[model samples]
Target: MTMMTLQDDLTTAAAKGNTADVESLLRRGAAVNGVNRFGRTAVQVMMMGSWPVAQALLQHGADPNVADRSTRTTPLHDAARTGFVDMVRLLVAAQADPQARDNQSRLPVDLARENGHAEVVAFLETLK
Candidate 1:
């Protein structure tokens, strides 16, 4: 059987919320900013609602500003979509572009508002 590539394991670990495995893979030379078939990095995967896994990835040097392929959506965009206030704050503190827009020209705040995440929308408004 062929062994899984580091990027593949990292993506799977992020998706599964496997913090320990993610950390291990990261320490074993996994690319913290590795992009999957969807152009999502480990950090983006974590922003998809896996806070613990995201935190682990972030601590390991995952780039919060990494953009997806088509939409160019950052991890902050994923955080907003999921209403993860802590993740949003972490991404912001990590220097994520507060005004970064997707292919549709929608910013993270716009997405939060569209998704009815009042608290997230309010926080994003404060950023501007």
Candidate 2:
């Protein structure tokens, strides 16, 4: 089997909420926007449900607008999927595209609604 690339390891660790590993990897020159085979970056993976990891990745230069391959999902999409209101706010504050659409043409707000996050759906409305 081939050794895991730094980007792959970083994304997996971030998805699993390993902040220390993410930090060490970033400090060691891991690309913040590096994509794995799934086109998911450390930021998107970390943004799943961990605000601290997402914030750390952002502070380390992770691009909020980086899109995945299939859905072209952004960190905002991941944050919305997890119903993380704070992370959503942070991404919006960082100028994340509120109108960014996935392959299914679903925006972050749409995902928030579909996921039944009333507060998030309301918050997105205010943004628009």
Candidate 3:
């Protein structure tokens, strides 16, 4: 398979929350930070509730702060937006930039608050 295929596969596996596939792809030379055809990295599209997937990607050097092409939203933004506090914690542990602003100039905490995720919002606020 081509390098691009590996990247796409990795992203797909991560999005599906398939930790084994994600780890296999990484070991097979898939770039941990590689973007797919959608211009999103594995971490960017990973299932927010899947901590094992997130952990595997992060351990393989996936960039926790890598922003989306159009919105500039990081993995932290997605996690916070979805009210997945565990995913947010995983991203933060990987050094994700909580202050990263999206195209709307909104922080991850802002998304959490907007989405009615009080716990996520509170958790992010404490990092400041």
Model 3, position 34, has a per-residue lDDT of: 81
lDDT of candidate model 2 versus the reference: 0.83
Top candidate by TM-score: 3
Candidate 3 lDDT (Cα, whole model)? 0.92
What lDDT does each candidate get? 0.81, 0.83, 0.92
TM-scores of the models, in the given order?
0.88, 0.89, 0.94
Residue 11's lDDT in candidate 3: 93
Tens digits of per-residue lDDT, candidate 1, 1-128, equal: 75667787889888887888998998899889877655577786662666678778778777788778767888898889879787778778778898998999989998888889898889888988
For residues 9-99, write the lDDT of model 2, one tens digit per residue. 8998898988888889888988888887566788766736677787788888778898877668887887787798988988888788989
lDDT of 3 by residue, 28-55 (tens): 9999988888888899899999999999
Which segments of model 3 are wrong by more than 4 Å? 1-4
Summed backbone clashes in each candidate are 0, 0, 0
Better of 1 and 3 by TM-score: 3
Ordering by TM-score: 3, 2, 1
**How many clashes does the backbone of model 1 have?**
0
RMSD of each: 2.0, 1.6, 2.1
Alpha carbon lDDT of residue 43, candidate 2?
75
Show the colliding residue pairs in model 1: none
**What does the lDDT come to for candidate 1?**
0.81
